[model samples]
Target: MRGFLASSIGVTCAAALALPLTLPTASHAAPSPTREAVPGSTQSLALDPLETSPGSTSTRAAGAPQEQGLTRRDVRPFSLVGVVWDDPDAQLHGNVQVRTRTTNTTRWSTWQDVETHNDDAPDLDTPERAAGGLHGATAPLWVGDSDGVEVRVKAEEPEAERAARPATLPKGLRLELVDPGEEPPQGSRAEGADTGVIPALDKKQTEDELIQARGGKSAAAGSRPFIGPRPRIITRKGWGANEKLRERKLGYTKTVKAAFIHHSASGNNYRCSQAPSVIRSIYRYHVKSSGWRDIGYNFLVDKCGNIYEGRAGGVAKPVMGAHTLGFNTNSTGIAVLGTFGSSKPRAAAVKAIARLTAWKLGLYGANPRGSTYLKSGGSNLYRKGKNVRLKVISGHRDGFATECPGRRLYNKLGSARSSSAHLQGR
Candidate 1:
């Protein structure tokens, strides 16, 4: 029964494949000419000048002088032709005859036979055979003779690869390899190494170094770390013409215990180049328009797999942001940068989310094993009435009626939970 089912499916797929090629279109009625042949003794021919159809008139004079037995006057009616054969050892044999005429003079005819031999030829190589030959294989080709002179043709590599290779290092950057045990001379610092090391750096400098180091580690681990834009400290005194918006007080909360995950609902079309602008826009929209003090999410993940800090981190208390319904007081909401209900989040986003969640969970000292204050049984989590225990990584919809996270992304909550568990060594 299984074999019968498999055969039926295979036959259905085969029929689907055959349907497209068999279907006819208006363009199919008049097939475009690909190649053309002209009467000539020349070793090479240019088909672009040839007429598209027979009986097409040429603008050149009929009494033009002939070169290599080829002229507009003596040229035969050219037509597009395709040569096909069952075996690779197939020859293309044809003859071109030129006839000369003058007023009140006897017409003279001359013939030139172009015969291609169906045998192994060194120069006449096809791309498929040449490609195979690159990996230690020989390609056979059928050679042709034009006017008793052997004509050779061969395929060459694509133009892109033929271009010169660029230097490895950037213009100003030079790299040198050092031996395993090699060290700089005594009391001598390396060229690019920093000598004056401060015991402690300012808050901004410390944050910058930490972010840079984390970015380096993330690159090495094939993951991404959250790196926010340069901290633009807002003063208590408002700045600029939009003084009313700036004067608006930013909201605050007691503490953040958990985080809510959400999809942007709009597709993953946010440009990575404009990430900083997008972050600022989100903040303005949340604060000015949504009547919230700051961006709703604590962090945002972009499609190119970059994680950005949404809410500032060093505040003494958690700032209130709208992400979850009942759990907003304890949850530090994180909204990923795509419409997840329609599209599956990329692997990088998943990894970044895992790392960020693990870090946040550690900071809050939240226990994954402990019963989650948020309820878990719903279409958003499992299904209604399922009665699952609250895991550390729970969906926004797991606790409330709102579809804070989309269906496709909500499914990955389990994976996030597992990643958190693994990171926590639970």
Candidate 2:
């Protein structure tokens, strides 16, 4: 499935290491939704009238299996889209397809599938999950800049065994149109380049920054400590994140013991230069459309080997993220920015995963090639409080019963693990 969300009261709203980590103190700011203040905006539209299968005379009752969507219509210029519903626990058992017309041309693209199993979320019962206004959401889709869109969602039939009852579509479905907005102006921050990317750092330099960010503390002493050189990363500010869109207070965990890999499932039609825009779109979707506190992933790696900061918080800190559903407490999430169910992921992207995991996991003295146990908060795969053993670097499916990160990319985790461990000098 592909991933992609927007505005008028839309839906609301990942890491760490093991040194005697000096966790950042939690600070709160007044809750605010300054959507109009930012260049980017979301346009939330309620899904339109229901439709029946062609030639079928029967009408769909309020709770019956049904199809819902909007006719082709003009909308604010948006680069991404997704469908959301009122109940976060509701399952959308069906298909969601959309076609979009280019911003200025009469051209309309063929219908594309939006992944419906978006169960990859914060662990249940956590403060983030408890936050008000959460919703059931499909994976956001990156559709590029477009001014017109048409969408349809159809509920599938129940299997023969369960045929006694049909699947009913979720309630209050809404279409989220998101504009990532313009990229930040050149030279937006001292630490950022004109292209909005932060430069890579050598091992020593990274260690220094890591120490500085951690209140002048150093990692546990070792003659030959394992740590990888920091990869070049695009900061949230560099990518033009509207800080005001997310909740002011950042959440954190005690330590990061695992890294869950995911594919944004937002398709692979984007150019490398457009990645920042894609990140921004996903950020808005997660916050404005889905009602989460911030973007779900701790970090995002583009197909070109470029890494972008995901959820806000110091990159080196064990900032809590809303990535892996049941095991988010002690883990970080890294999403590669493209669908990889059948299409192979880029070599550069795979390498970036290795490089990033090596550095981030190493902070907690974790071996990417090793395994760790995380207690399940709750998920379809694991019961709440269950102790599950998983690799330090595992795919999204490892903790949740969903085909996330995608099959092609999930198959490459072994190689990424080996390379990451090697980079950490393990």
Candidate 3:
């Protein structure tokens, strides 16, 4: 479904090693409403002149459904139009229309009415209308079967437009049709529920945090090549150490263009220190067991924020790492440790990620500020099904059908960008 909402831009990176990671803290709130809540009480009864008549008591059937209220007609199919802003509370008030072909007769049903308002609540405003033309000031949509219905939504207005009207939304807002029988959109949290903002980490802060968290000092010198001879064929250990390094016998060439982020998709309770061994097992499974050439990522980060050289990064040439899509030829992959959705990442881990990405972007000469770095067609940075805009840093879901980076880690993208911006300033 295509819907627009006023939103801000941000960044996301990958983490694939093992370690305890904590993301920047956020406030929590109740889940937003997917649709409007059902009303509990009926409207005040209007005294009918006929009901007060002497014999009217006999005419009023006690057990029958009330005809005085609205009634549902035959079901029809419809599509969603744009959602429009109605109030200051951020409560979304919008309309949806269904097109139907009943007995080969075509008809249009439009749902336009007001619902409750919420600036940052968890529930979406309920639909005021339905396919049967049943109308109410506010009515909850039936959650059971919406087989022939579609949905659309819009983003908030621009700053300039918002400044002028304060309460009005922009015109010609874009709407995306959500398919029937799908879950509704979620709402933002209420204010003051979470106080911490995800901020960018600078180089010094990153280094300091990593050092403290890992209980290890940084390499005193610049990066150097492995001292041993290049392997003719990568054994399981070789693949774990340098998965992307080509075997001269295999005739593989290095051509990385983009990086893809991913999560281990395992439970988050595992310790980060165990990641190396786990990665080694993964390599064995992929190569020795599955018969692939090497491991997947070019680099991996543990929960303690230590960066491990992987695949292409271990060699001088661009080694093909299974990171991103068509853009992998010019990319460097970095995977963080731990799942994000259920657990948060450590501040140290986020810092290390910023440092690494900053170094890599500078090496590639790619503008972190350019629109090209933002989400584009086929970018895999967010969830697999959603087309979330990507920053220079992206999540595993941004490109492929995998949940590589967990939500806790993915949530720090904005802070990563902020850190990148700070470096550019320096």
Candidate 4:
């Protein structure tokens, strides 16, 4: 096992040092030509200049410049949309809105806002952070099945002394249209009862699995630890994650000491049955469009309280994730599907958060209601190498200057922490 681990780490190091494997460069100077999403596949399309005027930059006010987006047009069928730019470090001080025409219908939805994720990213100097082709991106917005899209990005004016000047939009802005593709065929008499859902394990079964994961040897006398029952989880295969779309090597941390909660910020327009499709689309957007190693979160929950595995690593392992800027190490990220800025989070979803954290954090002997110190990798909130005290279960905004897991959701973390502790029997 040690040999295998060493070999895996070696591969991760080599891949990190290798060339930057970024998304294909696109020209954002003009309106992009129509593109198509291949059946059973995902696609990324760049937005062309929407301004009839010669420049990609337009003035919203005296000294305040704005960036134009693609003119409305028809394209291949897709179910999700987002915007990405050339530099991962650059911030888009702007507003992004998109409206799409439903497939085979004249009905065009109202323009919807895409949350600009200014700070959620991998730590500054890590291989994943420094990888070539990574881009600054907005939170992906799920748009269901559509063949037409229109987007607009307007820069907000700078604050204080710079109020007269318009904020600069990140360069190389492009539109990403993703088709989550078809759901995978269900398994017959497989691990998930042929329904794609991993059955929940009782307390004894979970302990046994934990023992097996720890080399199958019994613990020392009186050393058995308290643990929560393992909850049912939907597998990546169940969501039809195209393994080929992500990087071949998986990333890991030594241990998980914390869990960060987030909202997909992808809006609550989807049905519970469509949750798998939403996961697949975000997976594609994270890898194919955002140019990351994989989906940024370790686990995702639907509004119906169903848990779906995110990223490719084992669910029980401390898979390194990219969900929170400056604090991805030694922590897991749990994102509930949909925007919760104003919408109240569903009770089931919040309960699922507690249930997941109780079990996963219990495996590492962490008290979800307590606090721990983690060194910042560098963020707007903390400098690199600075150790900061954080709740064992925290919201995405706790570590970064962004509204994630949204307002209503963030407010619920206190109860989630208490419930998680209770589940762990602490």
Q: Highest TM-score among the candidates is held by which one? A: 2
Q: What is the C-alpha RMSD of each candidate to the true structure, in Å?
A: 31.1, 6.9, 22.4, 8.4
Per residue, candidate 3 scores C-alpha lDDT tens digits across 87-119 of 212323333322222223433235432122111
Best candidate (score: lDDT): 2
Q: Global lDDT for candidate 2?
A: 0.81
Misplaced by over 4 Å in model 3 are 1-258, 312-317, 325-327, 373-390, 424-426
Provide TM-scores for the models.
Answer: 0.39, 0.88, 0.38, 0.85
Q: Model 2: what TM-score?
A: 0.88
lDDT of 1 by residue, 56-90 (tens): 43323232211122232322211111111223222
lDDT, each prediction: 0.37, 0.81, 0.35, 0.77
Writing each residue's lDDT as its tens digit, candidate 4 over 1-426 gives 222222332211222211112212221121121222223555556656445356533554456556668878898899999999898888787689999999999989999999986455777777776668788889999999999988998777547636555556777888888888876664511454334456677666565555644555557535655567778888666676777677766667767789999999999999998998899889888888888988999999999999988976667666778888899988999999999999999999999999999988877888998999988988888999999999999998899888887999999999999998887777
Q: Give Cα distance to truth, residue 381, candidate 3, Å.
A: 11
Return whichever of 2 and 3 wins on TM-score: 2
* TM-score, prediction 4: 0.85
**Could you tell me the TM-score of candidate 1?**
0.39
Ranking by lDDT: 2, 4, 1, 3
Task: Give the runs in model 2 whose Cα sits over 4 Å from its true position.
Answer: 1-20, 24-37, 59-64, 157-162, 189-198, 207-222
Rate residue 348 of model 4 by lDDT.
99
How high is the lDDT of residue 280 in model 1?
43
**Where does the lowest 10-residue lDDT sum fall in candidate 4?**
11-20
Identify the runs in model 1 with alpha carbons over 4 angstroms from their true place: 1-252, 313-317, 368-370, 374-389
> Where does candidate 4 stray beyond 4 Å?
1-43, 48-62, 188-196, 211-223
